[model samples]
Target: MNDEVTRYIDGAAPWQTAVCEKLRLMVHETVPEVEEQLQYGKPHFLQNGDHAAVIAVARNKVSFMVFNATEIPVVKGFVRALGKGDRKCVDIAEGQEVDYAALADILRKTTIAP
Candidate 1:
């Protein structure tokens, strides 16, 4: 984890922090060689130096974004947000329960090691 990313996560709300941490762990588990840094005010995860995902924390929710997403995963208990191009993000509300298993599956299929 980059210092900037740590600071970003540490400064987030408790719920957001927890979700971000979970996302971070899942990202690493899915792609062991993934590199992390703060980009565009979010925690960016790179696989083989390619943009893979980003974790964003907002006032009301925390979002996990998958870049170059071809088919967005249908995750239970999440609000899907689509951005420009192939980027897709799933937002978890403040008191929402995340489906870590499903998220891990999605990341497993999405993240590329090289």
Candidate 2:
């Protein structure tokens, strides 16, 4: 885990901080070799030097994105498709109940070596 990434999460609002922490934990648990860094003011997870996932916080929501998500199924809480549909994001609000297991599965699938 990167210290900058930890600081980024620590600086967020309470709800956003919880969401960021959970997402970060999920990424690391799902991909043991994942590398973490603070990039573009957000926590980015990389696998073999390629973007695997990202955790970003906004005023009202926390967004978790899975890169290379073209094969990822549209699960609950996914609010948008990005980067020509190769990335999928789930936006969590203050009281939202996210299925972290499912999100972790997505991360595992998307980040694993072919």
Candidate 3:
């Protein structure tokens, strides 16, 4: 990770930390080949020469933005189940638990696809 990426994660708001960390770990574990980088002022996972996803700290919730949401339909329901926008974000509140297994599955699919 570069300085910008470090700063991005380090400077996240309180509510974003847990979700960012979990998503980051999930990406690293499932898509070891994808590079971790900071782009558009957010921590992103890149694969196949494109960004697979971005994790950001938001005012109301922590969000994981899938680069191509429509390509991965499984995430729609997953995100909805998390009380966030389906096919867009899997938001969780502070101190809230997330479905890590589902997250890992989403990351895996996001990275392996075209």
Candidate 4:
């Protein structure tokens, strides 16, 4: 993990930490080349010269925030997790189960696009 991401995760609550760790690892697995950084005090995953995505710990959920969620399929499946998003974010509760393979597929399809 990058120092920025480590710092961001360290600042979160225990549940947030767990969720963030899972998201972080999932993002890395899906896009190993995306640079991890701290943006707006949250962990951001960026593809070179492309729009970046952010993940943050919310009061009741962890959000995987994407710039264009309508363009991604996973956001639709996560109807329960979906919230009012300026871009489009997949907010997942700590206790809720996440489909890792599916999440990876969404991330891959969304982030790799030009």
TM-scores vs. true structure, each candidate:
0.86, 0.93, 0.76, 0.79
Q: Write the per-residue lDDT of candidate 1 for residues 5-66, one digit (tens) a residue.
A: 98999999888888888888888888788999998888999987889888988889888888
Give residue 13's error in model 3 in angstroms. 3.2
Candidate whose TM-score is highest: 2
Top of the candidates by lDDT = 2
By summed lDDT, the worst window of 10 consecutive residues in model 1 runs over 76-85
TM-score of 1: 0.86
- Candidates 3 and 4 compared: the better one by TM-score is 4
Give all candidates' CA lDDT scores. Answer: 0.80, 0.86, 0.69, 0.73
Tens-digit lDDT track for model 2 on 1-114? 799999999999998988888888888888889999989988899999999988989889998888998987665546478878899998889998989998887787787754
Residue-wise lDDT of candidate 4 within 19-46, one digit each (tens)? 8888889888788888887778788888
- Model 1 lDDT at residue 61: 85
Model 4 ranges off by over 4 Å: 73-86
Q: Candidate 2 vs candidate 4: which has greater TM-score? A: 2
Candidate 4 versus truth, CA RMSD in Å, comes to 3.2
Residue 10, candidate 4: alpha-carbon lDDT: 76
Give the number of colliding residue pairs in candidate 3.
Answer: 0
lDDT of 3: 0.69
